[model samples]
Target: VQDPKHAKKTARNQLHSGARLLVLGNNVMLYRHLLTLAQAKNHAIYIRDVVNVDKQDDGAAYRLFHSDVLEQMYQNELENNEMQSLFVYLFVLGDLFDSYLNRNIFHKERIIMAMRGYFFLNMWAEYIES
Candidate 1:
């Protein structure tokens, strides 16, 4: 378990050290449970929502996992992958590139897109959401 006071720093260090997968606990107890797991395994951990940072690297590989967000991404990726036709593949790739470009430039659009693309978009959203 993590003390709320230290959650932000713990999360930052974990993220900086290449912790790629994240499971968020919306409440203090859950957060602490996750913290304990991370500590037990000697892995760095971060608490979402409570942590504040000025900026984050655009290319960080970390992914925050939550139920609903995972489902959407899974569905989208599956839908994209299951279309056996080349035309569908091209269209998906084109959409992907376009989304990337829009996200790179437009703050609001990026948040909407990232929210659709991954869980915990807020971690990075703060940078662009401004």
Candidate 2:
């Protein structure tokens, strides 16, 4: 779970399951711990970043980053044994938000601006239809 956005839920689940939970200063430390735990448990771990897209039809390259909790979990899984473990990056590009342009009323133009920037970099617009 490299995503800090959803770390709270993951942390809670780990604690509830009687797994030791520790929050290191940085992602590197967290990744190390996850590796150690996976080895000890004899269970393969996998990791991948999950992208949450607000719109399916609106092509966006990268969507909302996963929550921190999720990110850490993913990192741990990846650092362990990505090959054997079932690592999946879930993307909800279409269902995460209403309109891609106006995630919030205040920043109506922000998404559009981002798209323009993306186009400039890639030399083409990528639109994902929901």
**TM-scores of all predicted structures:** 0.18, 0.20
- Which candidate gets the maximum TM-score versus the true structure? 2
Go through the candidates in order and give each one's C-alpha lDDT. 0.33, 0.31
Residue 123's C-alpha lDDT in candidate 2? 34
Task: Write candidate 2's Cα lDDT for 1-130 as tens digits.
Answer: 5432333234323322324432222222233443343343333322221112122211221222223323544555455543212122121211122224334644545565445544532431222211
Any residue pairs clashing in model 1, and if so which? Answer: 1-32, 1-36, 11-46
Candidate 2: regions farther than 4 A off: 1-66, 80-88, 91-130
Please provide, for model 1 over 14-41, each residue's C-alpha lDDT reduced to its tens digit, 9 standing for 90 to 100.
Answer: 4333334332222111223333323332
